[model samples]
Target: MYGGADGAVAVLSVAEEQKHLLAYAPLVKRIVRQLNSQVAGAIDRDDMEQIGLMGLLEALRRYGEPDAAFGSFASLRVRGAILDELRRQDWRPRAVRQESHRLRDSVRALTRKLGREPAEKEIIAALGITAEAYQEYQLAENAEQIGSFDELLQEGMGQADSAPSPEEQLMVRRSLEQALRGLDEREQRVVQMYYEFELSYKEIAAVLDLTDARVCQLNKGALGKMKATLQSA
Candidate 1:
């Protein structure tokens, strides 16, 4: 237990730091496990664990008494830290990222012109690509944009030095929900199943009676639309 005066900013004793580290080691492990399953082959689990531990230490160092539980706040910080590292070490090819951006722009343009979420066929036609080429593009874009939930969660959190207030968090959640509402029914289901339920693409495909490639395409398209909506909101 820390023996310092309440709410005072002071250098923690080595023992105090170690105590907090030991106490939160399990939390770090749990976060690493959850993120590991989402990020296969992109980054090693041990590396993520190390990054999570650093985040835990950072949380302990900067944390203040707030209405929210320390664990909740720490979890956000830990996950944010891990995500920061992932972004820093992003290995997606430049061409893939460019193509993904182009696809997103095309979707946004078509949605504006159609005054609704564009269908998959409409998107393909807007991009002036064959169905087979569109599938390849979707697969490539999906591969590059996979595991984007981190960014989604961190959207309104602001900087680490100024963690989001409870009200801010609530507003962010509401914004996310509203953005999701912009998606079509099928796109909404795909997002819920894949992210909320943590289902694999193959599993979601089976449940939705769509091909695996189609699921990936829908997932990427839905995410792109949500992102645009959130940004506009």
Candidate 2:
């Protein structure tokens, strides 16, 4: 029994990389959905899925740090991989791209006009899309678009990096680090996984021995807390 147990451990160790990639497939899908929401063009969900898979593969191949959760690390890789593909597609027609931009503008304008989130119907009407053609046009226009990496990376950097002097920058860094320390361990882990390490919730849950719901709750609560703290500070 001891020998068999040892043999099983060896097998599992060898298969860990494959296991990691398989484990985070669902996370890729969720991220893709998020990307879809942000972009305009024929950016099909399937295309994002494929890109995510490629990213997962790369992450698996390059995975380091056994102490870190695989999902957390792979999230960034998957997102980056998906975006890289979008950037490479130089063959997207000019008219289609233009229309996509216009559609986004329309959506934005309607949102402001209504003082709330606009529905698909409102977007279609604003874009002059016919009922019969709206679905097709929307799908096509969104297929080429995915989430932008720049926005994700720069979200809080502007405020944090605006310090005028080296001493001020150091002070800001220390302050941010101190603020981060006040979060609960789970919140710290979630934030690290999602932003710093780039793990998906699914992956973080697996590594942390928690459910997906709990991971999300902790993340959301942590963000809300952080935002409130920042605002008050």
Model 2 scores what on Cα lDDT? 0.59
- Whole-model lDDT values for every prediction: 0.73, 0.59
Return the lDDT, model 1, position 106: 85
| 33-117 per-residue lDDT for model 1 (tens digits) | 6556445556788888999999888877776333344576677778778877877887556786787788778878889999998
Window of ten residues with lowest summed lDDT in model 1: 1-10
lDDT of 2 by residue, 1-233 (tens): 10232222122343775676567788788777655543544467887798898887765555432323445446667787877776787546788768767766777788999999766567667777875455445444434422322223223334311112334335545655665677998788877776555565557879999755456556655665665554455
TM-score of candidate 2 on Cα atoms, chains taken together = 0.40
- Give me the runs in candidate 1 sitting further than 4 Å from their true place: 1-40, 64-76, 93-140, 146-149, 197-203, 206-212
- Candidate with best lDDT: 1
TM-score: model 1 vs. ground truth = 0.59
